[model samples]
Target: MEKWKKDYLKGILRDYPKMEDYYLERKEKLLFHTKGTHPHSTTETQNKKMLISISLDRQLINLERNQKVIAQCLENATAETKEIIERLYLSDKQKASLDLVADQVFLSKRQVMRLRDHFFEELAEHLGI
Candidate 1:
């Protein structure tokens, strides 16, 4: 992968958990409206308006789509792959180095690096990057 693409994928992996919360927050913000802004509008019109707003929200759409793609990729991932991802990207603690992760998982540092690379490749493919 190009350097930029690799960076982008790494960012997505790092922010996966936050993205879920952010998505919900964005959706809620989009759904909220002033009390009397559409006082005369019918229920169907309000629903349609909300649908259009959501469809037009590029950031929200991308976030939601990425979330789904990540979820799908993870669903079929091996246990070791998931462990590597969680320790390296999803942990609440300080980000782990390859050597640290390898020790925790009982693999060599080189093997840990390989697994991480493989997972990134799969994620990139799924994201079409």
Candidate 2:
């Protein structure tokens, strides 16, 4: 593999867990988005807490931006490639094992592994790596 491809895959793998967490957080927010306290809590202590929370939210916003770029790349891939990538790397609840995905796609485990390799190659190509 070339240097650029190595770097591309490295960055993606590094951020993969955080990306999954981002998806899970979105799901949780949908369930509890309206349950948070009002914006006008007047206790000085509470106000200080909100300011700290705002910085944390800013970090999440940046993660969302990075995820959007990745999501777009995945979106443009072929359906088979997209499914393989998602199942192999991006599932929030559980990482799909090679055997499981192979069963779903009716291929052998070796074939599924090859497809994953190909998926990363295609992703790097898409990113001009």
Candidate 3:
């Protein structure tokens, strides 16, 4: 993959957890709408709700599709590949370098790099990027 495409996939991985959380919060807010009389007519309020629901549905579909792609890639990954993903991409802590990840996963740095590259390639293909 091109450098920019690789970086883009990495960026998506990095944001995955945050994106999930954000959408969940949004979903909650949508569900918790205040019940009160408003100046707007019933049709106008319903139309507004319908538009918001449509927008949220689109966002949720995209999120779920990406999540399914990621899940499939992870399902096919080796144990060591999972370790590399958890430590390097999925963790909430600061990102680990390839050297640190290799040490933690009991592999040489070069091997870690190779595994990571392979994993990214698979992920990119799954994502249709």
Candidate 4:
């Protein structure tokens, strides 16, 4: 009947998929926690908008730092070296051979051979070589 009761019911329903039984078992405690008591002030709700804004800022900061690292790594690298690292690290080929990567990337075995030189060159440069 009350607005607060409606909001509490809605919140519980939304969380049903994630932890159905646990939520059901703790339904009384959960409801009591959300609908604050007189002295403990269980009725007060935290601002969802503020929490979301804080989380978004965190995600954006992480994104910017990651992009900066990527740019710096590529700044001193040759295009060929970038391709080699892609094959080695990003091609789902931790233990795969160069020939396989070459085939996947549509390059020759000789080109793959050159990739090794490029990989070391960039790696060393990245590590201040």
Candidate 5:
């Protein structure tokens, strides 16, 4: 993969967990706000709920769509490739660097870099990008 493509893929992986966290946080906020007692009138509360619901729904849809796309790409990949991608990105709160991934996978850092590049290449192809 080209350097830019590799960087792009890494950026997406880095952002994926953050986006998931944001979605969950917003969902919790929406539920909490809608259910909790407040000083607002019924009409005001209902309006607020409706707006929150719409915003949450849109965020949920986007998160789900992106997850599905990532899932599909992983599904099409070899087991090792999939594992490398997920371990480096989706399976943890903190993103793993290629060196850390190499250690985990028992490969040299350079080998891990190659795998990452190939993984992105395959993922981009699967995404038709």
Candidate 6:
């Protein structure tokens, strides 16, 4: 193996328990059965990244359809998700991550995660995702 691979492997070996559990949790219902086709099978590595990509894609579709719900979701908070959404929508930034959005909105990481989850849940239900 290459030097970087060894270093990465060592770390993964050390953190395998945590990493495996996390990967498995995020791996559930990963591929969209919405199409009813097999689609393409992604490797383990791609599967996780694809999951994140799918999540972000869904969020974008939600924003395009229901801008009001997003505003309502963030209207009462410390203005974190709202600011994030504004930055994304007003410009062509697509989506600002919770970390980047949190930093810009001056909200803690935990706060950003909570708000994003709540907002996304509402969007999911509204969009019938």
Candidate 3 overall lDDT versus native: 0.79
Residue 48 of model 1, lDDT score: 87
Where is model 5 more than 4 Å wrong at Cα? 18-63, 91-95
TM-score of 1: 0.85
Q: Write the per-residue lDDT of candidate 3 for residues 64-102, one digit (tens) a residue.
A: 777778888888999999889889988988669988998
* Clash count list over all predictions: 0, 0, 0, 2, 0, 0
Over 4 Å off, model 3: 28-52, 55-58
What lDDT does the true structure give each of the candidates? 0.83, 0.66, 0.79, 0.49, 0.72, 0.50
Candidate 2 lDDT by residue in tens digits, 1-129: 676676667467547658768755754554343235654555675556655554456546556655766677677777876677777666664667889988887789897777677767766665556
Candidate 2 — which residues are off by over 4 angstroms? 2-68, 126-129
What are the per-residue Cα lDDT tens digits for candidate 5 across 79-100? Answer: 7777788888777646577788
Report the CA-based lDDT of candidate 4 relative to the real structure.
Answer: 0.49
Tens digit of lDDT per residue, candidate 4, span 20-42? 34433444444444344334433
> Residue 115 lDDT in model 5?
74
Candidate ranking under lDDT, highest first, comes to 1, 3, 5, 2, 6, 4
Best by lDDT: 1
Candidate 6 per-residue lDDT over residues 1-129, each given as its tens digit: 245543433232233224445444434445543223335644665666665665766534443444444344446544555565455343345455657777887878787667655555554454354
Clashing pairs for predicted structure model 1, backbone only: none
Regions of candidate 1 where Cα sits further than 4 Å from its true position: 33-43
TM-score of each: 0.85, 0.47, 0.76, 0.35, 0.56, 0.36
TM-score of 2: 0.47
- Report the error of model 3 at residue 56, Å: 6.9
